[model samples]
Target: MKVMIRKDSKGTLSAYVPKKDLEEPIVSIARPQMWGGLVTLANGWRLELPEMAADTALPITVEARRVAGGED
Candidate 1:
């Protein structure tokens, strides 16, 4: 699925799923830089993000795979 990753004014990370019309704050990340690893959302959805540069800009949409804890 396509997920948009961004940081709010307060610098909180979040993921938005366009198809589902859902947006949730990212609660935890498997990798410190938050790429090529899994991110856990506040709603309990786990998404596997693609590999990207450490300095990749935010509010960017990227392809990610849903790994666990969400409805199809």
Candidate 2:
């Protein structure tokens, strides 16, 4: 799935994911912390992005994969 990541006018990071990729329509929005520029979705999918500008709109690809134990 593809997601669009950008910083809102208030300087908060935001991500927009398509409903087709989600299990259900989002009942609420959450401000999840980003760890190393990665955010895990409720559908068990993950998105990783590089360092981006505050006003940058980044298009990122999300895929499902198994992580090797303890790998970061």
Query: Per-residue lDDT for 1-72 in model 1, tens only?
Result: 999999999999999999999999999999887999999999889999999999999999999999966545
- Residues 1-72 of candidate 2: C-alpha lDDT, one tens digit per residue: 445544556655455656444332112222343423555544444455444444443334343232233112
Q: Candidate 1 regions off by >4 Å?
A: 69-72
Which residue pairs in model 1 clash with each other? none
CA lDDT, every prediction?
0.93, 0.41
Model 1 lDDT-worst window of ten:
63-72
Q: TM-score for all predictions?
A: 0.93, 0.36
How does residue 60 of candidate 2 score in lDDT? 43
For model 2 the TM-score comes to: 0.36
lDDT of 2 at 3: 52
